[model samples]
Target: MSLPADLCERTLNRILAAHPDLVEQETPLASLTSPMSPAPVGSVRVFKGSAVAKVVYVGLVVPMIQLDSHMIFAFTPEDSAVPHFTLDSVYGGAYHAFHLDLIPRADLASHLPYLDAAFHPLSPVFESAAGIEGLTPAAIGPRQRAIMSPWMLVNRASEEAFAAITEHVDAYAAHWSGLVDKGLPDDVLAGLADTDLAARDTAVRANIFSRDVDPVWAQVSRLLGDETTDAIRAELVANG
Candidate 1:
C-alpha cells in the first residue's frame, strides 16, 4: 500500500523540528538518474550532504524490494560524526537484532497520521510477522524466558549496567572455555559447565551462586514450572 504524501511530509517535518541537529535536504526524484537513482519508483532520499541521505522506499520498490521491501538508512560520514544520534534510532532501532526495518523515508510523514490514529503513542514499527505479542517473554521456552527476564530487568536498570552484564557473560564463558583448554580437571570443567544448575541448587557452596539468579529464574519457573526445568536439566546432565 502507498503511504499518503502529505502525512509523510508532516511526520518528517515533525521529526526534523524535534531534532534540529539533523540537516534535512530533499533529493528530487528527477535529479537521481544513475546508480544513485532510487530503485524502482516512489522512493525518495533525505540527505544531509555527500553521504547517503536516508533512502526511503514506499512499499515494494522493484529489484531492491526483491531483496527487502523495508526502507533503509544508509549512514554517511556526517552521520557517523554525530555521537548522540545513532543510525539505529534514526533508522528506527537496531536492524538485525530487533529485525526492525527502516520506515520508508517517503512514507514517514504519511505513516504518522495512520499510526497516530491507530496505535497509541506510535513509535517505530518493527517489521515482523511475529508482532509484540509473539515476541513477549511468555511466548518463549523456559531458558529463553529466564534469560529475557533478567535482561529486561537489567536493561531497565541502566543501559551501561546491562552492557556490563552482557560483557561479563561473554567473558565468563571465554574464561571457562580457556580453563578447559588449559587442562582443567574434568570435575572442575563439569562444575563450570553446570553453572545454571549450580545456581539453582541451594545446597551447593559455589561462589558463583547468587540469590539474584533466582528471581529471574523464578519468573520463568512460574511460567514453565519445575517439570520443564527438570527435563532441561536432565538433558544437560545426560549430554554432559
Candidate 2:
C-alpha cells in the first residue's frame, strides 16, 4: 500500500478502537466504480454509533493516471458541540495531496470558548506539521478554507514530507477522539442551544461538501459521474 493509504487505514483503525460501539452501516452506493470507469476503481462505506452520528469512508484508485484517494469523515451528533473529524489523502505517484481538519460545530468567530476548548489544543500539532520540509500549499481557495478550522492541514507534499505527516495525523485523530468522548465545557454548551447547534452543523456540512465551494467535486464528478457524486454529497451533508 502507499504511504498515505497506510496512514489512513491506521488512523481509521485507531478511531474504531477508541469508539468500540461504532457499527458499520450499509450504503446503497457502496460501489463507487460506475460504468463511467472501465474497471473497478472505488468503494464507499458508512458507519454509525452513539457518540459518532455517522462515519463515511471512500477509496478511489485510477490506474490510468496513477491516482489513489482515501477520504473519511467521522461526524459527531448534530446537537452536540463537538467538532467533526475529516481526513482526505490523494497520492498520484509523484505528489501526495492531503487535508486534515476538525470541522467546527459552530462558527469560531462568534464562539470563542468553543474554539478554545476544541481547536486550541490542536494548534501545536498543526504548527509542527506546517514546518515540515517539501510541503507546498494545496490548491484549495480562500472560500473553501473559511468553512473549516484555521488549523486545517492541506498541502501537497514530497514523499519524505508525506511520510512525516503520519505522526501528525495520529495526533490530530487522537485529540478529536478525546473531544468526541468528553465533549466541550458546560459553559461553552450553555450559550449554544441544541437547535442552533444542529442547524449550524447541517449548514456547515452542506457547504463543505458543496461543489460550488470546493473545486475538487468537479474532478470527482468526472471520475464518478454526477449521480454518484451527488449521492455521496448527500451522505456527507445529511443530518440523519
Candidate 3:
C-alpha cells in the first residue's frame, strides 16, 4: 500500500516545512531544545514518548500540538502535567496535530506502501503504518521494527498512564467485590458502588478526558486494530 502521491507530497512538505533545519543536519534526539518564549510563529515542541511523538505546535495556526512521542525510552518531563498555552495566548491561533514514531530508515522505506494506504486528510500518517494489522508485534520487518520498537515503548508509556488509572479502577472494583462477598446488604452495596463510581467519574471527566487521556486516545486509535481500540474507547467513555 503506497501512500497516495498527493498525500505523500503533502506529508513530506509538512515535515520539511516544520523542520527546515533537518536539511542541514542529522542531529541526535538529545541535541534538540525547547524554543524560548516569542518562539517561531509556528514552532513545535516534540515530546518523544516511549513509542510515540507528542508534538505540541505553537503558532498562528493552533495554540499547541499534542501527540505521542517516538523516542526510545523518552523520559516524561517533570512538568508533564502542564497544559500548553501557546494556542490560548495568541489570537487567531489554530494547530494541526499528529503523532510520529521512529522507523528505521530501511523499514520506513519498505513500509512506505502501507503508509500511503493509511493517508488521512485530517490525520497525518507519521505515527504508524496503516493496513498492516495482524502482523505480530515482533513480525514487523527489521527496519520497521527498529524504528518502531522505541516508538512502541513510548506508546506503551502513554498506555501505561491509562493502565495506571485502570489499575485504580480495578482496585475499586475489587474492593466492591469484597464487600459484596461479605454479604453486605444490597442497598449498602449499591450506595458504596455509587459513591466510588461517582468519584471516579468526576476525576475522569474533570481531569483525565479533558487533560491526559483523550489526547493519547486519539493517537492510539490510529495505531491499534479497530476492535481492540474501540474496546478501549468504550472503557474511557464508561469511566468518564
- Highest-lDDT candidate: 2
Error of 3 at 95 (Å): 34
Which has the higher lDDT value, candidate number 1 or candidate number 2?
2
Instruction: Provide the lDDT at 24 for model 3.
Output: 23
Q: How accurate is candidate 3 locally (lDDT)?
A: 0.26
- TM per candidate comes to 0.23, 0.95, 0.18
Tens-place lDDT per residue, model 1, 68-150, is 12222322222111101111111112111111211111112333332232221112221222232222222223543232211
Runs of candidate 1 with Cα error greater than 4 angstroms are 1-14, 21-23, 26-40, 49-68, 72-98, 101-131, 135-240
**Model 2, residue 216: what's the lDDT?**
78
Per-residue CA lDDT of candidate 2, range 1-240, in tens?
887788778888899999989888788777778565678788888888888888888888887778899999998988878888999988988799899999888878877888888999889999898689989999888899999989999999998998899888999999999998887778888756543887787788889998889887998888888988999888889746
Q: Write the per-residue lDDT of candidate 3 for residues 54-137, one digit (tens) a residue.
A: 222221221243321211111112212111111111111121122223211112243333222212110222133332232112
> Candidate 2: minimum summed lDDT over ten consecutive residues — where?
190-199
If both were scored by TM-score, which would come out higher, candidate 1 or candidate 2?
2
Cα RMSD for predicted model 2:
1.5
Q: How high is the lDDT of residue 197 in model 2?
A: 80
Best by TM-score: 2
Off by over 4 Å in 3: 1-176, 183-211, 225-231
Compute the lDDT of residue 197 as modeled in candidate 1.
33
156 in model 1: Cα distance from truth in Å?
Answer: 25
